[model samples]
Target: MKKIGILTINDYNNYGNRLQNYAAQEVLKSLGYHVETVINNTDFNKKNNKSTISNNKIQKIKKITPQKILKKVALLLRNNYFYNKRLETFRNQRIKVFKEFTSSYIIETDISITESNIPNEIVDRYDYFVTGSDQVWNPNYRKGSPIDFLTFAPKNKRIAFAPSFGVSEIPKEYHQNYKKWLTEMHGLSVREEAGAKIIKNLTGRNATVLIDPTLMLTKEKWLSISKLPLNKPKGKYLLTYFLGDISRERKKYIKEIAENNDLQIVNLLQIKEKFAYMAGPDELIDYISTASILCTDSFHGAVFSILLETPFIIYDRENQSSTHSMNSRIDTLLSTFRLESRLAKNIKNNKEIFEVDFSHVQAILDEERRKTYGYLKAVLNI
Candidate 1:
């Protein structure tokens, strides 16, 4: 069998990142290709070693005065003493969840590599390399790394499938670099139209706009792997999967909607909640699938809600700036399915429960899936 290696942001604790990785692997496997996710341990270690918010704050305080330095040390000790159990629990659960999910669903490289350290044996093992279905090209996420551009692969072996820039525009300084790296892709596709436009302007390449790999699978396929949490709420519940901050106004609206609808609000990202903190991809799908209504500020949250045919309200991310806005992904997705009305722009206008008819949405998804499969088949010569 032909072998394919997928390079993506797979080491994160986020539901969307891991699910997209698994989805891409499964899709390729179904095509009769042996697929393995490349685990870059050096990148993973670097991300984990980065200073936390409290550590960064403590660093600022250390330079103030001798007394403040003492206070900073005390604060650090106190925080570690008080929160160690919860922090350890979160870490252990997340690691277990990732291990269980990946071992059961996806194959991964036994050896991890950094950009400067990739083995030729590893490179030669794959017939083709896919760089991927997430924000791998987003500069903020990549931290100026060229790994996501398949720089390690030979020009003829590189393929980009629904890889996202995660921003509306690329910075001017990186245009030349993007052009150079992307010039070598044998087949190119992006998750958003804005990304496709950026590629066109930079490399004069007309990239295809493809659906996320998570959407390439049917709902039945997803449901087959989804496992409900033991403590899943029994009654009708309003599921919230916000990745960004929730404003007071939005919080009020969410509460009001839940109260009026007699629904319990289940927050998937609420750190204070044990259940939320322990949720993995399977639990995430279970919550969205079982929810009476879903509210989120997440791209994957909206994607799964739509796929499950659950009524949902998508909120814009808080504190979006000109250069770093991620709302375009959600905007493009809603527009594609003709479900723009589902966007919760104003609380007053969204007083009633939102209802979505997925019949038309399913038709659009079917056509997009067809195009995506056709692109992959032609590019891989399957």
Candidate 2:
């Protein structure tokens, strides 16, 4: 079997990252290729530490008024506890789940690579290199990391599979860099229409818009690995998987929806609520598949909800700004399935009854899967 090495943001403890990584591996395996996920230990460590530091700095700056500073200091002293412990706890729990679910599923390289140094022996070992199924090309996430561009690989061996830019447009500063790296790829595909447009603008290459790898797999394939917690609530539950902060009004709306529907609200990512700080990719599939309704601000959350045909409401990520907006991915996803009605903004009233007809969705998915498979087959010459 020809060896295929995948480079992606797999070490992050996010549901989408792991699931997409797993999906890419499985998809390639089904084509009879030997696959292994290339773990960049340096980038992994950087992402973990950088996110924590940046978040803390942002929060401190936001709350740095004179009175608020004093209040924060007083609260810190009064609590008499190491608040950083909470963050550590969350990180540890997420790492545990990542190891158990995501890590175990992929064939990982024995040797890890770093951003500054990639061993030539490792680079020459793979017949082909693939980057993506997530926001691997997003400048904000990478902070100018070129690993996703497959720069170290031979020009003919580089392949981009459903890698997303995660933005509607590439910033002007990065256009030249993008052109330099992406122009050499043997095959290029993106996860959204906007991403394809960016590639076209930057490299003058018409890129194919492919479905996320998670969507490329059948629901049965996902269910085969799903795990449900023994303590999962009985009966109807409103499952939420918000990655961003939830606003007061949105929280109230969710609560009201649960109360009216006689459902319990189960938050999957709210660390303070303690609902599910340890949900792995399998558990996430289980939750979405079994939930009576889903409310989320995450791209994978919406994808799973749609795939499972669960009633769902997708809210825009909170406090979206000029530098980064997650709306494009969600918009493209919903539009692809003709499910734009699922956006929370489209609903005039919280009390209004909502439903999704997946009959049409299934047709679209079937066609997309064919196109995606064709692209991969032709590109890999499988």
Candidate 3:
């Protein structure tokens, strides 16, 4: 059988990242290829990402008053970055759950590839290396990480499958490097329309805009790997998952919705909710698929909700102006599915927001899956 290596984000903390990684691996395996997710971590990526982060922090500090900055810092330390950051207890169990899902579901290469050790022989181990199904191309997040582009592999052996830029425009700092690496890839496809535009502008090559790999699999397939949480409530509930900070007003909106609908509110990402917060890729499919309604600011959160045919509202995540924002991918997703009305900023007395029509979604999903499969088949020559 032909062999393929998958390269994606190292963040197992993220539901989207791991889900996409698994989806990419599963799709490749179904195509009759031996697939393993390459574990790549590097100090080079870390240093660059840190530099960018510190620079952004510095810029942020420069704009705010000393009192304001101190208040923000104290707030972050106290509430742990408003629920995005967690105490050691949350991280410990959450990471364990993440790894459990990964070990059980994703087939990974035995070797951990890093900057210091590139493993020259490994290039021959896999027929092709594919960077996929996530925002691996975002310079703010990736720091123009060469590994994400599979630069160690021969250009003909490198393929980018539905990787996203995550922003409308590339920062000027990463332009040259992005252009060079993107141009080198043999087969290119992106997850969002904005990503395709960026690819065209950088490489003067039009890339196919493919659906996220998570959507490639049917509901029954996802359910095959899904598990119910042991402590799940016996009652109907409204599910909320937010990767960004959830403001007081937003929480009020969620509470009001749950109260109005006579449903329990379950915040999957809330660190304080120890029982439900330890959810992994496996349990989340059950949580999302069975929810009465879902509210989220995450792209993947919206992705699964749509796939499960659950009523959901996509809130615009915080920190939109930052270069690191990945909201463009979410925008492209809603537009593609004709669900633009679901995005909202204010939820005061909006009864119409709860009603979603999934009647037209399956047809779009069918066409998208066909196109994605066609692209993968031709690109990989399977």
Candidate 4:
């Protein structure tokens, strides 16, 4: 059996991240390979919590006010102390659980939490290294350079499976950096076609556009292990993926659109009972399964909507510069599936947002799933 090391984002509660990890694991296991997700021993809840609200823009806005100054100081001091205590508790509880989870699983591959944990010897040990499930190549994740992960593993045969460079346009400076690293890859597949174009432009290689890893697994497989709620209301509802706080005007428009439809408006970003950013894979699946329609700003939100045969309206971010071409990846998917009407060109002031029809696009996704299976078969040589 070929030993494979799967590298991906699984620390966060992002549904796309978990689904992608599960998809790759499922596909590899079905192909009869010995596989394990390389987990890092890195501490997520260190002295500074990565997901803390203080690091966010809201805290930055409160920095300049006199009253907010005292509040900020108090918040910082409290946050520091609270953060330290949470770090210890989190380390004791979560990290211990992670270690136990890793050990319990039949993991042949060594898991490294941080890029630093990936040793030179471990790289040489694995036959193939699969890097990516979501926006792993995004500069934000890679500390300003998406290809920084490549610098860590020199000996292993590397491949990027359904990797996204995040948004559309990469700067000319990063383009040169991408050219050097991407040339070394064995196989390149991107989640979006526009991302393929970007990669092709840089490497002169036609990247195989694959479905998001989550699509590789059927709903049955997901349902078996996923945490789904019982007794969903038997009515039509819209799945709203507004993690980034939509304006009141947009919220009003959505309500107007759902006036008669019994819309099940699910704000994935809304603070849950636990005060986390959003629900995990199980919670998201339940939300997606019941939603008759979806209005989303998240890439994965749109993805799940399509997979579940739900009609969707995507609110892609506005690109102000020619250099900012991130939405093309999403645009390619929307256009290919003939769901251009469902894509909101203007996130905030979309006058025609209510005009999306889901029937034709639902059929298109069915056809795409067949193609997705074929791609998987080819990749796995099944």
Candidate 5:
């Protein structure tokens, strides 16, 4: 079998990131490639790239002394100490949840890849190198990570599949490097039309816009691996997942929707919601799959909702007008499915929000999957 190494966002705390990593691996595996995700250990290269110290000293430690709470009672007396402690606990639990999915579903390189240590010997090990169905190209996210573009690999071996810039426009700061790095790739594709447009302007070459890898798999495939959260409600419930702070008005609207749908509300990202906050990727699939309605501002939340054929409302982030806003990707996703009506901008009535039609989604998904497969096959030269 041919060997392929996937370089994506080296994040484990996100549901979408982990899911996309697995999706890319499985899709590549199905195509007869021995796949492993390249782990970017930027955090591990502490000798040369040491992180600056913040006022909160406890944030740096991640080992034995970090767990001893009573011994550090003095720090607890500081302002907002309890709040910081709550956040630390949430991070620990959620990472554990995400780690389970990575361990079971994805194969990773034994040696973590970092800028200083590329493991030069492994450059020839992979027949091809792919960079992602996630926002690996997003400068704000990866800070123009050359690793994402497979800069370490030979030009003929680089392939970009459904990678996102996360914003509508590439910042001026990244333009020069972005152009050179992208121009060198053997194949290029993006998740949103904006990214394709950006590429066209930069390299004067058109990039195919494809659906995210998460949507490439059928709902049945997702359900087969989904595990039920032990504390899932016996009855119907509305699920709320937001990466940014949700407005009070949105919360009121969510409550009204839940009341109208006769469903209990479950806030998955709320740190105080212990059970829901600790939900694994498999449990997250079930949560979204089984939701009466999902109200979220995340791109993947919208992706999964459509795949599961569930009713959902996509919210515009508070930073929608900012250059760093991620609204464009969600805009593209909704537009592609003709579900632009699902985006909550001016709908005042709760009934109008749930009046979504998904009858035509499957056909679209099938075609996008076909296109994704074709692109991957062509890029891999199969």
Candidate 6:
């Protein structure tokens, strides 16, 4: 089998990022390739060193004098300037590991590409490379530059699967840079249609829109590998993700709706819930499957709600935008799947009861994945 390298954000604790990374790895295995992951560990020191920032220190900073705050800002600017100078070179170095996954398997590099110290032996090895799943292309990731992937220079081929620019719109300077990257890529698929349009506007290329990494696998497949709830709650409850800003209003609205329905809220973060902490992919899928109704702000949260065929409302709670600009990508998905009525009905009156049918969106996701897989296979010459 051919060897392939997959690059994505892989934090062991963050379920969403982990699921996407695992899904990318599984997809490559399905295509009959021997896959290995190249991770960057820029945040390793922070993740490993728990003492870097303390709650006490944060509280103290919060209460510090204005002069101290100004001094802190000055220090931050100096630190950032020095950090950027070491980023690219630091990322080019790497380390190799032979992990046991049923059998012996190898994973090369750390989690943060910008600060990775990959060994020379693993630097230029691999038939092709993939960068993506969760906002790998987000400009914020590489300090407003696309140099992270470019610096690797993977030989043979390169692809970006279900990658996201992670924003509704692209800025002008980055827009030009994106076009350059697209021209070099052998294959590309974006998770959101808004991103696809942004690419087209910037590059005039008909980039394929695809499903989130979570939808690439079935609920059954996820359950097989997922961590089970510590204990299943005996009572019925609603599941929802907490978002900022409008969340308070949306939460109030949804709670009222649930109360009227006589169902309890199974606040995932609260005690007595099955998946209490940072949940994994399978745990999330199982929770969605069991939820009576889901209210959420996250795209994957919405995706799982549909995947489970559970009724849900797409509560727009992101303070980042007003009703007009708020998660238009989400609006697009809801409208495309005939959930516009539900959105309108929910917003028209949060008290108004409604149900959503996700069969159409699920089908669309499947079709998109089929096309995405086809493109991937073509790039890998499978």
lDDT score, residue 148, model 3? 91
Highest-lDDT candidate: 5
Q: Model 2 segments beyond 4 Å from truth?
A: 44-74, 77-81, 349-354
Residues forming the 10-long window of minimal summed lDDT in candidate 2: 44-53
Q: How would you encode candidate 3's per-residue C-alpha lDDT over 1-382 as one tens digit per residue?
A: 8999998886778889999999998888889999999988775555653442355666765788876988876764466454444466688888998998999988888788875689867998999999987888886677788899999999999998899888888999889989999999999999988889888888899999999999998989998999998688799999999988899998997898888888998888877788888888889999999998889999998999899988888888876675566788998999999988788753335576667889999999999988988998898886
For candidate 4, the 10 contiguous residues with the lowest summed lDDT are 271-280
User: Cα-based RMSD of the predictions, in order?
Assistant: 2.8, 2.8, 3.8, 5.5, 5.9, 8.2
Write the number of the candidate with greater lDDT, choosing between 3 and 6.
3
CA lDDT for candidate 1: 0.85
User: Measured by TM-score, how close is model 3 to the native structure?
Assistant: 0.89
Candidate 3 clashing pairs, residues 3+ apart or interchain: none
Clashes per model (N, Cα, C within 3 A): 0, 0, 0, 12, 0, 14
Residue lDDT tens for model 4, 208-240: 887776766666765665555344445766667
Q: Per-residue lDDT for 1-382 in model 2, tens only?
A: 7999999886657889889999999988888889999987655446645543456655765677876887776675455355677867888877887888855687888887777889879877988999998898887777557788888888888899999988776778788889999898899999888888888888899999888999988888888989986468888899888889899999998998999888988898767655476777788899899998899999898899888888889998887785588788788899999989888878776554346678898899999989988999888887
Off by over 4 Å in 1: 44-51, 54-77, 346-352
For each candidate, what TM-score against the reference?
0.91, 0.91, 0.89, 0.74, 0.90, 0.74
Q: All models: lDDT?
A: 0.85, 0.83, 0.86, 0.63, 0.86, 0.63
Model 6 Cα shift for residue 323 (angstroms)? 13
Tens digits of lDDT, candidate 6, 101-159: 21222254443354455556554566787877677666544444443344456534667
CA lDDT for candidate 5: 0.86
Model 1 poorest ten-residue lDDT run: 346-355
Q: Lowest summed-lDDT stretch of 10 residues in model 3? A: 44-53
| Runs with alpha carbons beyond 4 Å of true place in candidate 3 | 48-86, 345-351
